[model samples]
Target chain A: MQVTLMQGILIGIFAIIAGIDFWWEGFYIFRPMIVCTITGLILGNLTLGIVAAGLTELAFAGLTPVGGTQPPNPIMAGIMTVVLAYTTGKSPATAIGLALPFSILMQYIILFYYSAFSVLTKKLDTYAAKGETKKFTQLALLPTWIVGLSYGIIAFLCVYGAQAPMKDLVNSMPVWLSHGFEIAGSILPAVGFGLLLKSMLKAKYVPYLLIGFTAACFIKFGNLMPVAIIGVALALIEYNRSKKDVENEKKMKAVMENVNNDGDDEDGI
Target chain B: MESKNTETTPKRGKLTKHDVKMLGVRSLFNQSAMNYERMQADGWTLAMMPALKKIYKNDEKGLADSLKANLQFINTNNYTAPLLMGLEASLEENGEKRSTIDGLRIALFGPLAGIGDAITWFTILPIVAGITASFAKQGSVLGPLIFFLVYVAMFFARIPIAQLGYTTGTKAISKIRENSAIVSHAASVLGCTVIGGLIATYVQITVKTKIPVSAGHTIALQTQFFDRIFPNILPLGYTFLLYWLLKKKNVSPVILILATFIFAILFSWLGVL
Candidate 1:
């Protein structure tokens, strides 16, 4: 289960590309599923990679960076999840639990970058004042390179340098602790769903939520497609109703304006 | 006003179609230099560079002033940002006052962020991710590919959206604001529904605690009690507890994640989970 130097370097290179994409949000290849899949591909474990991608994706589903706030970094979590599972010969669930520290570590690093990059604004101001478009453009793009390179170095170190320690740590874990990690992994997706609901849930929409929950949990289906179709249907109905409401409101306003115009004409006469 | 500007300032530079296309391309880097001080300000100015350069080709002072003005604080959804960029560029092309362009930019970003977040982040991606995660859970390769393609499509969508902004100019503002409310409401309806289904399907919580029903016989709590009453009740309740903590108590997600780990491990140690 030892990671080769070549594998580590490839993973590091992938990390750089994903890291820049994550920062720029140019293409969203940094999601846990994609990151894990690529890592698995590099490590020559495609099935393991796909399995971990599914589990890890759900766990990190609702942990999106909204505004300034960031959840634990998905790229590191994704890379380490597959790596831990691959190196330690454990289930994806257990690897998810073990990979959390790395994710949080990256989160802090990114936050640090956010604060550190604040210093560049003064540099930007100066460039603008001097009308140095070339320097300004270069400086503007500098942070992305820094972000990508940092990801590369960290991924390389974690994958290659820390393998022995990670393996040893996994071996030393008692049955209870390892089982506990498994349990934690299974329960973590609830937090993601909760975060999503916090943003999207509304008092009026609670019924649709209940319907979806009921259908998915109680009714037997081969997959969740039926439930999703129901959701789409509801969405269509809601969309049409709201559109009509807007139209009706506009009509009412038009009528009000017409009456006002009549009143103005009478007053002028 | 148009006639007066054309006669008096015939030397004013105009942005070509190529310039607008480049602006859309540059908008991809809108968050490249994101920071805490002014957020996406530097990136915003960079994205507007091509148009700014062309419109102010002979006026260095005007170019610098526009750059300084654009470098002020700006935070908005990256996808919808090109719309504002196009609008600002058009205004600058028309020789609009600096205050007018700056004021409109500030005024529009908040609403654009709200609409973009609602449509793209909350609704479309989450729903797609949920469905695709199910496929990936079963080890289907289509999962990642589909999600990647969908996102790529969204990335390219910036071109047409930017074009829409440029052609419609300021007149599009009222229409966008009018439709945004309805669109966001419908989007959230779908988002909530999908999230509810996702919670039921994705969030797994099992209770291993057993109770002796009769002599030498134990009933499994998870199956015998919780399942008989309502399947996935524990997951639903747990999701609600976390939601309540997040919304009412204002607990950070990082804290919630850590606490979930601790409690899960503690419960596992107690043989309750």
Candidate 2:
């Protein structure tokens, strides 16, 4: 069954709520797994939602935002992919298609929140001036819960309601066009892979990657054997070859021993 | 109970460019730990301390200064919400309504958390982890060994960023801007690879068939295809094609999805996934 647009909106709402509820933990709360799980519950296929969530999770498992650099939105992708997959039978890749825009929209929301929070500091400052230390902490708690709860509920409803209508709409489309959606699904995951590969393929390490892949493909060995054996052998060889100042160490040791004997001889005489 | 030293010692002697570079990592790490929103309200105040010393040293402001920033190099704070909450609660205690502050914060937290998590844990870690882990997962008993090597490199690499964040935040933006471009490019390269790897790992498919030999026996896929060349390379190729089209063509993922469904239907009708 295709998801009715109303259901699509519901799933979105559900995602928003669960997404920001981690206020105590602050803005680090929005995770793909959280949104995906909510999506699963909304779509009434908790298991598939989990699987989708896990795949998305592992795919972006190493996201590390350093400073202000941008990172691709995994939670948005996770939610949409689940919605699409459960409602339309598209694979994980197809679901990723709908998630990107939501992720982008969420980004600006963060910018606003970050800047707006500064005002709270001013209020706290005012309290601090009045010699009311306890009041400063109190002023901070209200905003945290309000925002956290709002995001949680909004996501819950958006995802929950969107589930049915989106499925219906997608399914009701011409059968041929439906086929087209499936085709799109197959090709989309590659984008995720490509994004990953752009970092993996470095100029120096290309040989290691190729060799590892080749050994996996060719060698009739047990799991994880060929690569490990070769890697260890190469590492040992490199360590041995890179031994620095070997001759200098020997000369330094000889000089130290000579000095000790000379000192003893002088003392005895 | 013991105030052995009234002031902390600063590093003596002229600092080199190398030292400056290393501080960025340290500064970043410290910035990452800037939770407790009220404390973090200065927005990189911890970083600007060296410069802050010049401005506020021995000033009449009686607040003691002890600051550290930590987020493991993904420089976003988790304390802001609580910080706001604390501030609001304090105001409430003083007999003022906090509804407006609540609305303002409600509107703020969701979007920031969404992007922050995505960038920190999603893009940077995976790309770095995937490549770093790939070395080990491919290694067997030595795999764990390889993982440690990568981990050490990443761990040590972060120290300077943390320090730099603290030092740079203290002064002007001139020094920070100079290095941002190179760092961004490096980050992008890493991020791009993750984009690729995430796709590669997404959809897993298996095709099974048995071929009969002359002696009245069938061969396993392992025995038959294992002897052939580039056995799983086809999947890699497929991912590349998808990535290129998406990036170059600007085609919507939805359209591509429709195409995939069509393809799957045709393949299924012809019996292929």
Candidate of highest lDDT: 1
lDDT of 2 at B17: 45
Q: Write the per-residue lDDT of candidate 2 for residues B1-273, one digit (tens) a residue.
A: 125222332221233344444333323222221233433333232332332223223431312221111101122333222222223222222322224433433444443334434334434445443333343223222322333454446445444433443343323234323333333333333344334333333344333445677678886553367436445655556655655675667654435444544565565444334
Q: Which runs in model 2 stand beyond 4 Å of their true positions?
A: A1-18, A21-30, A38-44, A58-66, A69-72, A87-93, A111-147, A175-189, A193-201, A215-269, B1-273
lDDT of 2 by residue, A156-221 (tens): 443555567666776676754454344444444454454444334456444444554555555554
**Roughly what TM-score does model 2 have, to 2 decimal places?**
0.47
lDDT of 1 by residue, B161-252 (tens): 88878888989889889888888888888888888888889888899999998999999999999999999999999999999999999999
Q: DockQ (C-alpha) of model 1?
A: 0.75
Clashing pairs in 1: none
**Candidate 2 positional error at B259, Å:** 13
Candidate 1 structure quality by residue, lDDT tens digits, A116-136: 999999989999987899999
Q: What's the C-alpha lDDT at position A65 in model 1?
A: 81
TM-score for every candidate vs. truth?
0.95, 0.47
